[model samples]
Target: MKRIGILSDTHGHWDEKLETFFASCDELWHAGDIGNIQTADTIARFKPLRAVYGNIDDFKVRSAYPKVLQFRCEEVDVLMTHIGGYPNRYEREALALIKAQKPKLFICGHSHILKVIYDKKYELLHINPGAAGRSGFHQVRTAVRLTIDGANMKDMEIYELPRS
Candidate 1:
């Protein structure tokens, strides 16, 4: 089993609580809008990171991470992008990618709204960890933690803090 921590839309801010919450996680996934390279570096130092460059990210961040990331973790096929939208309302590029790649898990961040929905049409789990940083219009900063065991994903948890 692999413990995973997921967050997005940091816009350059990092919370001290994040370190403690993700301490036991085997990997960290950043959906996008990471804000700056330092924030990315900090997370990378804490744990293995899989990330995509967000709209607000600078050249340095874009150079380090791709606009879209598709990979496998154990038995799960995962797809991540910064502005991929959600299920039926997916962006053109994201919809095309979803049709072509057919990932078991699809993750994206942009709206800074937390969502965890199962897409029946695509047979995939969709997650948006919301805005974990102090920037943005989000009322609450949120992050997600879950366990992936083979093809099963379980024990999902959400951590929320008032945006400071």
Candidate 2:
């Protein structure tokens, strides 16, 4: 199995708590809103990062963030994007992507709040790591880790990391 760390909406700043959260993963998937290349450069020190361009990400950031990433890791097909579509209308967009990609795991981030939902309606699992930035909402601060096997997945358990 692959230990994957998922983070999104960093908004260009990183705190110590997120550092601890991402330490255990083999690879990290950044779901955009990175805001700057410096953030990506910092993360690269820990693990290889796969990223996508967010509305806030710019040219320098895109150089580090890919629009979409697809790869097989630990026996699972993983697809990642910063914002595949919209959260309020996730089902429709997710179904479309699911039908087209047929991936075992699909991850996205754009919402600054953590979310992990399994849509039986479309047979897709979506993960959002919330914001790991200084301007993020929610007082506790959060991030997520996903463990996967072939076509089986579980909800991402949320962890509140301290701000330092």
Candidate 3:
């Protein structure tokens, strides 16, 4: 069983609370818009980081991460991207990738809105951890934590803080 922490849209903002919330996680998955390379380094220093670059990221960040990341965690196939829309509303590129990869878990971050939905048609779990930075329009910053054991994802949790 591996504990995972998921977040996105940091926009260069880092909070100490994130450390506390994700302390137990063995790895961290960032959806995108990581803000800067320093922030990404900070997160990587804390734990293993799997990330994709968002539209807002600069050349340096884009160089550090890919636009789409596909990998396996335990027995689960995972797909992650930045602007991937959820379910039937999936973005063109995202949809094509989904059809090709057929991942069990699909993760994205761009809307700055938290969502956890199951796509019955594709038979995958879609997770958007929302915005964890102070720069977005989101009223509350959020992050997600979950346990991926074998092929099962369970013990999901959320961390939220009012934007100030």
Candidate 4:
């Protein structure tokens, strides 16, 4: 089993709430808008990171960060991108991209709303950890960490960042 830390839409800040629990994860995945390479470097200090670029990401950031991430963790293939916008908006582009690859876990950002919806029609699990710190509803800034064991995942932990 591999413990993974997932966060998204952190435009530029890493909230204090995440500091303590972060280093314990086996790996980290960012849905992007990370804001700077320094952020990536910081994350690297704790564990290897897999990241995707958000719409706000610049060319420089794209050069430094992964545009898309695909890998196997705990027997499941995972695919990640910056925005997994609803079909009503992008109309199948995101779905097409993900479907073509057939990853067990599909991660994305951009909406700033947290979602963990399963698509029975496709047998896919989609995750959107929402704004980790930099942007969101302002009601709360959230993040998720979980352990993947075979086809089953456990230890789903959520943290709400302290108000800034």
Judged by lDDT, which candidate is best? 3
The TM-score, computed over Cα atoms with residue i paired to residue i, of candidate 1 is: 0.98
lDDT of 2 by residue, 1-164 (tens): 66778888888887667778777777788888888898888887778888887878899987766777777776777778776653346546555766787776677777677777765654556677777776655555567886665555544557775443
lDDT string, candidate 3, 50-160, tens digits: 999999999999999999999999999999999999899999999999999999999999999999999999999999999999987899999999999999999999999
**Over the stretch 1-164, how does candidate 4's per-residue lDDT look in tens digits?**
88899988888777446767676788889998887777777776767888988888778779987767888887888888887764334326577877688877888887777777776665667888888865556567777888999987778887676446
TM-scores across all candidates?
0.98, 0.84, 0.99, 0.89
Show model 1 residue runs off by greater than 4 Å: none
Each prediction's Cα lDDT score? 0.94, 0.73, 0.96, 0.77
| Rank list by lDDT | 3, 1, 4, 2
lDDT of 3: 0.96
- Clashing residue pairs in candidate 3 are none
| Global Cα lDDT for candidate 1 | 0.94
How accurate locally is residue 86 in candidate 4, as Cα lDDT from 0 to 100?
48
How many angstroms is residue 6 displaced in model 2 relative to the true structure, after the best TM-score fit?
A: 0.5
